[model samples]
Target: MREEPVKTKNANRLRDERRNQKDTRNGGEQTVLTEMDGIKNAISDVLEQLLNAEFKKFVWHLWNGVGADIERIPRAALENADRQDVVDRMVQKYTTNAGTVAVQVLLNINQNDLAKQLEVKLQKASSQRKGSALLITNIRFDKSSQRSGAEIDEENMEWLLGALGYSVEKHTNLSGEEINTAVSNFSKRYEHQCSDSTFVVIMSHGQRIQNKDAILGVHYDPNEHPDDIFFVEDIFSHLNSVSCPALIDKPKVILIQACRGDVCAFRDPTNGSFFINYIVDMFSTSAHKYDIMELFRKIASRMQNDPRFSQSKKLLPCIERTTLVKKFYLFPGLMK
Candidate 1:
């Protein structure tokens, strides 16, 4: 009887040990699976939050006139929405706008199929008698002195203008009086030079005070006019229809690279100053006949939308006389 009882007890203990082992194994597997699920959920949540934040930032930047660097965004991110659909929507939006449609569609294209039918609009535009371009850059660090960048700016202007087939005559370090004299000489020379299509670009250090506008430069001659004088309106006014009938009705583009007032803060890094660079890049790559005003607007929009230049509100081309809404178009190469 004692042997029988011991045998039974051993059998029961063995069964209990086996059951405990199985339970322990199951518990460990459950714990691991639970931890993995939690980690997966947490990761998903973080990605969702990040994507939402970035999208909001992009929209905000675009609306504020600071252009977002679309290229910087990951392709996977943009894949959320069909890229073709997005582009189509953007085209529709731009084309439907009041002034945009008139200039982009009506003036440029007589019919809807015309622009699309052309294999190369740039070549076509180029074939229609090459026009002349003139670029002027004047950077005066102080009222009395001119910086090296001024000359560099002028040289860049000359090269770019020359490439565009303009007989460019660039001048640097000219005082206010000299500018007036140069303008007069330019007017006379310009009339004598290619009397067909012409373009003039002026880059300088300018300021807009209450009602008066001023362009600063160095005075070389003592007998010359004052260095810091108000001649902004006077200079441009000279290019009136009556003054230059040959240039009348022709596209006369003027670009001014200067500060509008002393209230601007130079807190942004130099790399952020991409206005001139962007213009150059666009000009070089542009294969179609682009409207100058439209180009300026696009540049302004890009600058205003970018986060790096969020603080800059005054960096825009001050256009007068011409209707920018009616005049701007990108050349064929730069368009698509």
Candidate 2:
């Protein structure tokens, strides 16, 4: 083969050996390790382990196009891509179909930090329920008031919490000041110092003031006086790790079955409050051994899916600041 004469400018690189490892022998295309390439390598390393068969299974029910995308580009194809484009096709696929599944599946992966955190939460919940207590403040007005069908919720909560093996303290018709005192005194209980967890249920009418959510006592009427309301923050702050050191590492299980603001759902007007109905229905059949959050998730799911309210109303319980430092279980062994 005749050697072709190299141009002077191009020959300088070969003579000086200054051009970085490019050679024309085998269609020379050198891979450069840029900062972005490093990041891509790191991310791909993590994602290769994350987007496994387990994750695909975890979100099979939630994601819309995951199955189709996985089918369109076979796993074998993804495995055979060049280094740079290995994750590129996948990134495009997930972006096009939306990544709701990818994000949610991160929480359930067995070895990921999120799944480990949830495991810690589960550990705190898995202990025996022999010592915990559920304090329920059930306040339905004395016949003269307009709110009805609330007493049914009070009864149902007792039966459910009792079945969970929580020693129940039922307080009826407490005034605003009395509610404060009841909760304040409850926070100082000797049992909390040694108990695994505590459950507080306050069923009443509530309205927000200056954007702060507050629960109303039976005395609250159209006047809306401050004395007749107990701010929800007070409940949380009162039982916080600082105020009540006894509950420092314990789960403060709170369920407020109250109307926040005036957001009312059109119901049968006789069956019951929408939130309570779902709560009772779900808790009645709660799993014998599982996390309390599982029961909570079920209630939220049913509330969103219930035919009557799905279009009109959507309700989710406000779960906050579980500083238990571990997972918890409310394995109330029987459905009483």
TM-scores for every candidate against the unseen true structure: 0.50, 0.55
- In model 1, where do residues sit more than 4 Å from their true spots? 1-134, 139-148, 190-196, 220-227, 263-273, 287-290, 312-314, 323-336
Instruction: Quote model 1's TM-score.
Output: 0.50
lDDT of 2 at 235: 87
**On residues 91-116, what C-alpha lDDT tens digit does candidate 1 reach at each position?**
33433221222123222223334323
Candidate maximizing lDDT: 2
Supply the global lDDT for candidate 2: 0.54
C-alpha positional error of residue 75 in candidate 2 after TM-score superposition, expressed in Å: 72
Q: Candidate 2: deviation at residue 62, Å?
A: 58
Question: What are the RMSDs of all candidates, in order?
Answer: 29.0, 25.9
Instruction: Please report, in order, the local distance difference test score of every candidate based on alpha carbons.
Output: 0.42, 0.54
User: Residue by residue across 1-336, what tens digits does model 2's lDDT show?
Assistant: 100111112111111121133333355433212222333444354445554465454433223333443434455545434434544654455442222333334454444664444334333333335444545443464322345545555666666566555778778777677788888888887877667678888876666767877777767654554467788778887888787898876677787766566654222224445565565544444343335677777877766675543464455566666554454655432112
Worst 10 residues of 1 by lDDT: 1-10
For candidate 1, the lDDT comes to 0.42
